[model samples]
Target: MLTQLTISNFAIVKQLELDWRNGMTTITGETGAGKSIAIDALGLCLGDRAVTNVVRPNTKKADLSATFDIKKNKPANTWLSQHDLEGDDECILRRVISSEGRSKAYINGSPVPLTQLKELGRLLINIHGQHDHQLIVKASEQRRLLDNYAKHQNLIDDVSYYAKKWAELTNELERLQTSQAQREAEQQLLQYQVKELDEFSICEGEFETLENDYKKFSNSQSILEDTLTTLELACDNEQFNILDSLRQCVDRLIQYSDIDGDLANVSTIYQDALIQLEDASNDLRHFHERLELDPQQFQVIEERYSNAINLARKHQVSPESLHIKHQELLQALANISGDDSRQEQIFVELDKTKIDYLEAAKRLSDSRSKAAGEISQLITSSIQELNMPHGQFKAHVSTKEGEQLSSHGLDDITFLVSINPGQALEAMHKVASGGELSRISLAMQVILADKVTSPALIFDEVDVGISGPTASMVGDKLKQLAKTTQVICVTHLPQVACKGHQQYFVAKLTDGEHTETTVTELSEQARVKEIARLLAGDKISEHSLANASELLAS
Candidate 1:
């Protein structure tokens, strides 16, 4: 159950700390007094969207936090343990919204995504909004309510899981089954490509070797000329050649070798350089002798290289990578041929998944049918208590065994109602008036209270448009609801305000420059005044106070 709420700089609230208790707590204020602001703050902490301007004016950020004692909330505690967010006995959910419109959520003290906060919040509290009845028109909402009443989420989940598996299997089968013509065409094209690469039979690294040899033979004349010129400069020159100059320097240095130590080192360096130059000149002459210009060989090698280049270009592969691409094409052809066997396997999977989905969906349908009968009777009795004595309510779960499977299983649930004694049962949206719908929505909540998992339930003006005895009945139901769980109700009716275990009064205060909302837990006398203020005008009177006291006493 929720134990504490702290709100700061949120909307018109400057700062507020509220402690909650286990039982029905009524929050009453005049219209537009911001009675729902605390609820809004709680919603934000529960991971509701943080819209722009949510922060108090001139404030950089808004902070909201809620503390829950999960000692009795096993589901919430289990979730915490699963996420490794467990504490001694408390869980804190917090939301911070910057003035720049960025928001962050935290579990305990660790940051989390908004989705995780919302998921955990669902287990901690259930908020029944004022306009929840408006959603009765939606078929999905109707189905969800019935499922909630059924308390068979495992069945629903199984159905969903099986349905997803079915979809996946069917999709795979279709991918392999559809486009048969295209698949065959692709196979044929791959076969032709493989044949062409096989016939070409270009060996690995063959293209580079062929290209190098062709270039060497084509440029053989220039190669020989350059070789001859280098040899002439180094050793073949008739006079003033580099080799001769080095030889003279060696002899000259040897003469002064004993005269100076540095001169002796120079003599050794000159001698080594001369020997190296002679060796290089001999190697160059040998290379010139071995070189041969074979135009015919060059022409043959050039033709082979050009074909290799053309083949690589045709296949869109580098000449060096052509072999790799050939192997890839071969693998592709093998995979294409194996598709028939793979397709057969997928067909078998589809059949198995279809059977699984049908079984799960059938179980869900049975559960829904049983839950529908049970909840319908409860809702009908509760609606009569809310001043609809002649009203007849039915939760009809129609199962389509012959139709296709859906995520929600084979059931289509409809909330049927007959507001008049002899009227035929019909959908709530088409039959119930706004007042009737509100009462019905309330009755559903009252009946489904114990069926829910949340330990705390908040009702935000769900009794709007209801007054007098109906409002009194609404309050009685809420008070009864608190016997099993904590209930927080924001209401305007004095009848409802008088039925609280604790009462808080909301009011707007302003001095012309700044406006703010404040909530005060009322004392016995203050409670009476606030209830009286709700009954009559803002001006309290003896008669109204007496009436308020009478209501509270009852």
Candidate 2:
């Protein structure tokens, strides 16, 4: 759930910090008091498009951030882990918009693209604007919502896979029907390339081995001569070798230890040195015996290494990558061989893939057809309770049997509604009243609440055109939704504002030159006064306070 929000220089809000709690909370104040500031700030953190106007006057930039607790949000934590961004149970998303309209986003303090921020935001918070009903008119949007409600992602994925396969095979079939001469020419070229690489036969990891061996062999003479010279000086010399000199010094030191006190310490050092020199000479003699360098091997290695380099240059690749290129050419050659037979084989495969796509699409269509009716009835029941007792709703799933296949399936889903008893059901956009659309949108959201997996839900003036018991119905719906997740609403209606588990008052403060908007969480006594004000226009009389108190009790 959303845990905290901090805004700096955003719109009229110079600085604000809000600590959010679970369940439904309402924000209410006089008109133009910046009641929507919290929603706007959260949208920016969620990667909403930003412009210079969002920055407060005389401010260089607008900064916004939101924190979410994701310990129980598996999808969010999984996404973070997949992207190497996982941390503690808390996830903080931040955004900074400069006055020049340039913006930057960060997740967990690491700079990220807006696309990533938006993707993560979808899993944390969902903000519903007053005009979201306008988006419900798009058929694509309708389809997405219905699909989410249907919860048959596996069926959808299967249809998509088969549709994609069908497309690939169709394109291949068209290619196979093209000119035969071009195909033959392409085959001949691939054959020649494959033959060249085949003869070279540079196995994996061989390029590095070849280089190492070449370096070792080319310097064999110097390595052997130097080793022999060092061996003779260190141990082979009878009169002046290092081991013999160290031993003589050790014997002299032991003999003079009693004569000088400092010489006693020097005797121990000489003895240790004698031991170390003896061990070093023995190891050197062992290494000298194992050293062997072929006199004629250098020329063979030099030629092979040169040829490898030339092959790499001809192929336009590094010598170390030549083995990978060889494998790629080999696979291409295999794919290009026997074009005529392959074309015939593709014709059969294409038919099978087309059949598979249609079958899977049919299955998905059936699942949607079943889910659509259940959702339609659920929404109808909701709208009837939202002051449209006689309203009718239906999700029409029109499946095209012989039409072109789509990645989503063969169904065209549309939402039809009628807000009056004698009215004919029609498309939502064709209706006249914005208030009716708002109610329908709310009804749909209420029915499909489970589909919105985000931990927090925010409604900005969603009850704009509602009043009386209808506003109370809307509040009931929001509070009911809050049973599963946190709900925050900004509203003017006392009926809705009074239904919150907690309430906040949005107020604008000004002296002369500067103006700022602030949000304060209201106490019990304060809530009564505020609700009374909402009920009776800036006045809190005794009767209004009594009514407010009674409403709170209920």
lDDT of 1: 0.90
Each prediction's TM-score against the native? 0.81, 0.72
Measured with C-alpha atoms, the lDDT of residue 193 in candidate 1 is: 94
TM-score of 2: 0.72
- Give the clash count for each candidate: 0, 0
What's the true lDDT of residue 62 in model 1? 96
| Candidate that scores best on lDDT | 1
Tens digits of lDDT, candidate 1, 360-470: 888888888888889888989999999999999998888776435578888778889999889999988998989889999998887777787569999999998899899
Model 1 clashing residue pairs (backbone): none
The residue ranges of model 2 lying beyond 4 angstroms of the native Cα positions read 178-337, 451-453, 539-546
